[model samples]
Target: MSAPADATASRVPAGPMARFFRRLGEGRDNSLGLLAILIVLVVVLSFVSPYFLTATNLLNIGRGIAIVGIVAVGETIVIIAGGFDLSVGSVMAASGMIAGFLVTHGAPLPAAFAAALAVGALVGFINGAIISYARINPLIATLATLAIIRGLGYVISGGRELVISDEAFLTFGVGQVFGVPYIVILLVATFAVFAWLMPRTLFGRYAYAIGSSAKAAQRAGVPVSRWRIVYYVTCGLLSALAGLVFVARTGNAQPSAALGIELDVITAVILGGTSLTGGRGRLWGTFIGLLLLGVVNNGLILVGVPAFWQQVVKGTILLVAVLYDELRRNRVEEA
Candidate 1:
């Protein structure tokens, strides 16, 4: 009888405590796995191309990823809250044009920059309002606004590129601080703020809760609509900031600037483990995703990959990342 009871106990499933420990172990393993992959990629690239490890090349990589990373941070927030903003690229273009117009009219540098940022926030606010108040889907609302904003950009520029000739602004575009590019510094600051906001604040927790389960969050007294709007507005504000950087870097506002940027921004966010279905993502993951793409781009160039092939490579990587995320998600669900 004792032997039969022992056999029954052995066949029984693990308790919650045992399961929790297993999950914790799996989480650590997954984290280490990603870190190992990153290290291997770095090491392999350095070996394959002598220039891949150079300071100058690393700086180039940093610069390339900076804006995308910034935008991805905002995207990550909105995604975490269970929404999408397709208009971000267009907002970037519009905000840049707004700044150019202000500067051309003798507006002070600071004022022009602020005005540009305001435009971006306003656009975001509009998106949020339409989605929440009007009860429209986020994707549809943002897509509509995207078209409208892009059209407005063309009208504002009279179908021309507004050449920015401001020396001060140009300085910011090319400036550096403490051996790091200004763009990189800006990206770091943005991420730091977001990193704190998402994990430590009421708004952040509510945002994630809402994304994870809107109905449940609502019942729990979370302000779903209000926080959703805030996320989109924040995204808009960041996109506008990216626009300023673009104008500063390029010294021109073309209606076509940042074309298809939304896709790239989303790609980075998704690659970083942010789910499009919402509720699961990390700002750090988005940062890593941006770096992964940035490194691939820079490394490809160093290896003499054709410019067109670069696009193909990026697209392929994005697809693979998405697939991997889906598989991982399904596995988690099954477990």
Candidate 2:
């Protein structure tokens, strides 16, 4: 009997270990697989280009990805909530133009910055209102807004770029903290905040609920429409922030800047494992996805891949990611 008790006691410890391994496997299924892919890409690129592993080159790539990474956070949130915002690129243009134009015209930096954020909020409000109240489809609404907002940017800047000479403003783009670029710091902070928010907040839970089933969420006392509006507004705010950062980094705001960036942002988010149909994803995954794209772009240039082929490679990746997501979704449904 004592021997039997000893065996049972040993099995008790094994049970916890088994549970731990099971949870680890689940996390791997969700994100660790993507992490593994990123590591593989990094190793391959390091072998393909001597400069790819250099600190300077790595820092440059981080700075290059900063803007897109910031926007990707917003895109990830919108996707998680089952909405789309094709106008983000346009919003970046318009918001940057507003801030740059203001500062060039002697507006205080604070006021100009505030104005840019306000512009983003206003646009987001309109997007949310139209979708929530007018019942317009998000795709159609944002697509129309994309053109309208781009046009507005041109009108505001008279089809010219706005140059800002403020030293303080320039610092936002170029400054470093503890050897890390400010833009990279911003990207990391944004990711950190959202990562915490998504997994630990009531807002996140409600957003996921709405995305999974709006009617069901409503029945469960979630204000689906309101939360959706919040999501769109949040997306708009981040897009504006990205615009401001872009302007600071480049020292000018072109009315046509950020063209086609939406595609990149969307691709990164989707590739990070966010379901396009909504209701599942982690910000950490999105962060890795952003890094993967950044590394790929940097690696291609370092390897002497022609500019034209770069686009082709990116397009192929996007297509593959989308197909994979669709097939995965189908399997889940069938199961």
Candidate 3:
């Protein structure tokens, strides 16, 4: 009887908790786990701050993170392709200044937008070309361009803010539909498009392949150089688009706009589980990361934390996320 009972127990499937832990050990719970963390954070913050769950504040959070979320989408793409763009913040300033300069000079709204996008695309192309063809390190390449682009922005804006009064142009920034902010809508749409693009398109597969192993991708006829350029250029264009939204939201294009935004974008991307080493991430993860940051920022302010301390918290979070990512990478390699 004892022998028969032992055989029957051995044949039983694993329980729910066992399966859950097994999946987690296999590293399959990344995004889902992050989402769970985000939910807990939201619930806790809501309880700690009465204003947190208010509709007004909720909408405000959406508006606040709109630009960061938008630029982060591009950063996600670039990082996934095993590159970085430290110049996105600078590019945002330059692009916005270009559009504001044009609008103030009587350029039509469409023309102004076109010029700004062109500037962004041109800068992106340069960054891509240097990295892909000249074989420059992405960090050094984008950092150099960061300074150059920022200087250009200062020169173009004459070291001052370019304020625009064009209602038509401003509408893009301030407009809303069905009581929802246009900027928020734009952010959601951008994420939706890329979310589709990444999993459903060959371009996404090529990006993953390149990030996994550029040499292997090259051998597989993945056009590593071309795709790299495409990723950087797309990053540039998206950063520029975010700049336009920034200008709209703020009603001015200051040369200093989006300063340090790259840090926030990169931090969000990494926190969202997009590997800093590349090739393993999801767009939705980035979105959740953005929301997490936004919630923390808002919660801190609502709970009366000083502004400077918020920076400290953000920096600490970024460091921890990076360290965890490195450890996870090591574990994956060892496995």
> lDDT: which candidate is best?
3
Tell me, what's the RMSD of every candidate? Answer: 4.3, 4.4, 2.4
Candidates in order have lDDT scores of: 0.86, 0.88, 0.91
| Residue ranges of candidate 1 with Cα displaced over 4 Å | 1-32
Taking the tens digit of each residue's C-alpha lDDT, what string does model 2 give over 156-248?
A: 668988778999999999999888999999999999998899979977887788778888999999888888889999999999999999999
RMSD of 1: 4.3
On a 0 to 1 TM-score scale, where does candidate 2 land against the true structure? 0.92
Q: Which residue runs does candidate 2 get wrong by more than 4 Å?
A: 1-30
Instruction: List model 1 lDDT by residue over 43-110, tens digit each.
Output: 99999998889988999898888777878888899999999999999999999999988998899999
For model 1, what is the alpha-carbon lDDT of residue 70? 78
**Runs off by more than 4 Å, candidate 3:** 1-21
What's the distance in Å from true for residue 294, model 3?
0.6
Per residue, candidate 3 scores C-alpha lDDT tens digits across 191-288 of 99999999889879988889888999999888899899999999999999999999999899999999999879998999888998888889998998
Candidates 1 and 2 compared: the better one by TM-score is 2
